[model samples]
Target: MIFKAIFSGFGGQGVLMMGTSLAHGAMSNGYHVTFLPSYGAEIRGGTANCTVAIADEEIASPVASEPDYLVVMNAPSLFSFQNKVAAKGVIFLNSSIISERSSRSDVQAYAVPCGDIAQDLGNTRVANIIMMGAFIKKSGIVTPDIYLKSLESIMGGRKKGVAEINRKAFAAGFDYVKD
Candidate 1:
């Protein structure tokens, strides 16, 4: 079974990092994965998005015309990609910034206050990581341990305390969605 997901938001929101982390986690879990990123001309404020495909078998393409999961960190991303989600797909929206909900009834939508959670954590930069934690918990595509390990690998070179704060942020997001 192939699972495709699209993560979108403003460039500074770490959209590509979210997709890349998921892809890395999936790959580390012995799944075949692909990561494709797109961005506008502007470096920080422009639109940025990425598609990640994970499967037991090799993937044929990196593109996801109709993704199984859509994660939107901003309002514009929700409007731009909501219709592209396949029927019965899942959508995770950052309700902290986007007040509007998905109009589609066929899909399951989750509202996570990622920005607010990160702000409460004293680092708004980890908003993407918070969203990622929620997505992983809900989707069960990859274990949180593996995802954190992948995240640590990706951010290992960063300054001290970054990983700890990200872990806390992930835990908060994961806890926000009850099973």
Candidate 2:
């Protein structure tokens, strides 16, 4: 199976991290993966995005012209990437921050309140992880257990207590989608 996904948001919103985490998870599970990140000049609030390709076979390229899945954390990202989603694709949006809806009817939409969910979990920075959880649940790209372990491995020595906080954030997102 092959899956192409794009995660887009502001610079500080962990958009790249989300894609990186997915790539790591896919790689750990014996999938071929590629991660490519793009960002604007400003560090915190400027546009940032990444494309990740996961497949059982070799990846031909890192660029994703039309992705099967999209995780957009803001209205701008939705506007920018919505049209590029493949037919029958799935789009997950941070509805708490973005009031706009997708115009395409062919793609499935999951309007999870990622920002609010992260805030409720006492950390707004983890909104991306919340989205990640929802994506994991809906798409079945990677199992939660595998993703959690990959997350922990990726967070090694990043900061104190960050792994646990992110773990809780991911669980919150996963539960939100299941319900």
Candidate 3:
């Protein structure tokens, strides 16, 4: 199967990290994948986004002109990428930081309180991880177990307890939608 997704948010929100994790997971599953990242100059609060394409066969391109899925971490992201999604595509919004709603009816939209969930998990930085959890749960591009393993692998040689909190954040996001 071919799955094209776009993750967008402000800088320092881990938008690129989430896309990279998905790309890594797809690679681990023996799928061909491509990731393209775009961002502004600022380290934080500037626009940042990434496009990831995963498929069973050779990928023709890395640009996601019309992605099958959209992960919006803020209202601006939702507004910017809402019209770019293909019909019947899925959109995941971080409702905790964004109070607005999408105007599209042709696509499936899920509002996830990623920021609040991360705060509840004791670290607001993992809000993107929470979003990743929700994305994995909703998109099914990769299994949650595999994604978590990928996350741990990426965090290799990091500070102690980072994996535990990230795991909990991922689980929180995963269970948030599952329940």
Candidate 4:
């Protein structure tokens, strides 16, 4: 089965990183993966988005016309993309920044306080990773083990303590999903 997910937030919110890491993790899981990061002129604090697609076969498009999953880290991103989610899709919203909620009944929606969770975890920067965990665990798009490996590789060779916190964020997110 093919899985398509869209992640959106302000530029500095690690949207691109999340998409890339998801793609990498999916690839590690023996799936063909593609990631496309969207751009905005204002950069920091400006809108940003990324599309990640994973499939056992070749992917038709990197941009998701109808995503199986939508992770919205802010209100505007939610407003812009909520309508594009497939009827039976899963939407994971960042409750800390998204004041608006989807009215669609067909899609499975979960608003996780990722930002708040990250804050409690001592670093709000890892909020996107937290949401990624929820996305993976709930959607089953990629295994948490693969996700953690990808995350470690993404962190590069330096930066002590970051990997641990990020791993915790991912674990928290993964564990939060309703089984």
Q: Which candidate is the best by TM-score?
A: 1
Show model 4 residue runs off by greater than 4 Å: none
lDDT of each residue in 38-63, candidate 3, tens digit only: 84465656789999999999999999
Put down candidate 4 lDDT per residue, 56-125, tens digits, no spaces: 9999888899999998888999999999999999889999877778988999999999989999999989
Candidate 2 clashing pairs, residues 3+ apart or interchain:
none
Model 4 collision count? 0
The TM-score of candidate 1 is 0.97
Model 2, position 38, has a per-residue lDDT of 87
Worst 10-residue lDDT window, candidate 3: 38-47
Query: By the lDDT metric, which is better: model 1 or model 2?
Result: 1
Local distance difference test, each candidate: 0.94, 0.91, 0.90, 0.88
Q: Estimate each model's TM-score.
A: 0.97, 0.95, 0.95, 0.95
Q: For each candidate, C-alpha RMSD in Å?
A: 1.1, 1.4, 1.4, 1.2
